[model samples]
Target: MTESKAPGAQSSYEARKPQTRGRTRENTPLRHNFWVDLKELIAIPDVASRLKPPPKTNKRLGLRKTAWCVFHQVVGHNIRNCLALGFQLDELVRGNFLKDYLQEPQGALTTAAPTEDQGHEVPIHGEINTIAGGFSGGCTVSQRKKYAKGVMIVETQGLDLTLEPDLVFTKTNLRDVVSHDNDPVVISMVTTGRKVHHILMDQGSSTDVMFWLTFNKLQLSLDQVRPYVGCLYDFAGYQVEVRGNIQLCTTFTSDAASRTANIKYLVINAPSAYNILLDRPALNRIRAVASSRHMKMKLPSLEGIVIPMKSNQKDSKRCYENSLKTKRGVCSVTIQPPGED
Candidate 1:
């Protein structure tokens, strides 16, 4: 029987034996060393970080150099506009590696230093309760940390504003006693070569608005207006229709200094006492501070000098009276139609 073994049968059995042996591989232990595992865990995040393309410069596009985020020393975008870095910062706060930046901007020094355990440096100049807050309260850490590392600060030729302590409102500021009320800080600002009066500086508003009639009076035509689809709410609790939008180089000046800003104004056809209103957007742009009690607004000029604008109390009162008269006239008008009694 042994000699009778089929010659081809042995070859077939050998082939089947290899397949049967392959199943035993399941019992073999996975080759994992402590060093290898540790190395792999450490290399995981680096692998992901490398997936992003490197930042580069193109001369043909006439583009500025790409901003480098100082927080992580990445070469692509600056800290001001980096969302990933912002998220990391927030995560650090959540992890208790850094203090929450929800406090007011006091005398706390906002300086960063290197730490032993942290992968990157963090602001360690002040305690959690004494940390200096940012200018805006919109996003807790977004705007405040924009220039946190002091790497995005740039020098521009025109109207480069620098906050000065002297700009703070004081009791000595000249204000009209006759126009004392909760009325907005109405001042005169030069826009498009016209000394626009009755311009209300409203911090509560989120936009800079220019009445349609005032836009026309500025010698600007409807064709110059860009198409804008937006709604505005008025004091009468009605949604005012927006006609269009126009960008004008608005200038605010004092005797010693002057600052100009390219203000984007939403043109709306609405009747109000103010010819134009400068709101939070414009205020933040110019770094201007308003003091309703002082009846004035102040900002840093191009030369870093404090520029102050005093409210036009007399014109304010006059405009208020005119608005009241207009309101009364509209109320007195009666419409009659032919009807069967």
Candidate 2:
């Protein structure tokens, strides 16, 4: 007889031994297969949900077509017959088959007759024969192979498509130049009142504005012209001539507002034949500025010409502020009508 061992002694001792470290488990990083997931996710559904199909023309038509093709079997027909009878196929399978069939062949000779068979001479002009047969007649194996190969060649060579002709219209961006003859500052004296067309308010200029055209149109002569000298600058930092001067009374106005001003014309000698241009001096005199973005004018008295600010409001603000500051408080005095005065 042996003293009875303590009941739980062996079990407790075994538990304390850090349990024979069976192979240490390693954390292998998961390898993701994007193509595999895409394939599985787009696979057709199982039979049951597929059988009870929905209407054809609605949003679920694709899904319904897919389900119908998967679950509903055509007992007595091949794929061609099924297609002829208007049976839909799963979109994935159809698209895949189309892509593969439509793929341009890369190699020169895709198929040839079995050399062992001496009786079967391969036709050299297979494609022409098939075309002559008008596609309805079954194409010979050789012909089909040639057509596929030729089509692939054409596609791969990028020679099958015709180029479209360019149909764009081109125009010149003429710089408005004010000369002694065609002063930009124009005065339209009508029954409504005297309106000043400040050509200088247009920045796409190489010269300034005056009423020379208006003066000529109004039958005003050069006798009123006085000797005047003022330095004018262009966008490219080039100085322009402001030699001879002619004074006139002009009225300026907009639909909702109006103003009158005394316009002093400076002779401008420009290269091109432009009618009138409002140079910086005339712009400064009328307190006007041109906004390139908005394609409008801003006058001191009337509502400034509103040009569409560009996409960034901050840039637009900067442009407006810069223009205003550069041509500060300079303005022409509004003159009264001849009879009224």
Compared with the true structure, all predictions reach lDDT values of: 0.54, 0.33
Summarize candidate 1's per-residue lDDT along 118-216 as a digit string, tens digits.
221222233353112112222233433454545566655575334443578765774344447765578998987889889877665556778887987
Best by lDDT: 1
lDDT of 2 at 135: 19
Q: Quick one: RMSD of model 2?
A: 31.0
Off by over 4 Å in 2: 1-207, 211-214, 229-243, 269-273, 302-341
Model 1 gets an lDDT of 0.54
lDDT of 2 by residue, 1-341 (tens): 32333322221111011122222111111112122322232242431222223223322212122332222231222212122111122221222322232233322212222122111112122223211211111124454456667765544445322322222212221123211222222222232233322223433332334534445545656677676423444433444444466656655555545545665555544322223445554555656554443333445443333211112233334434444565332222111111210
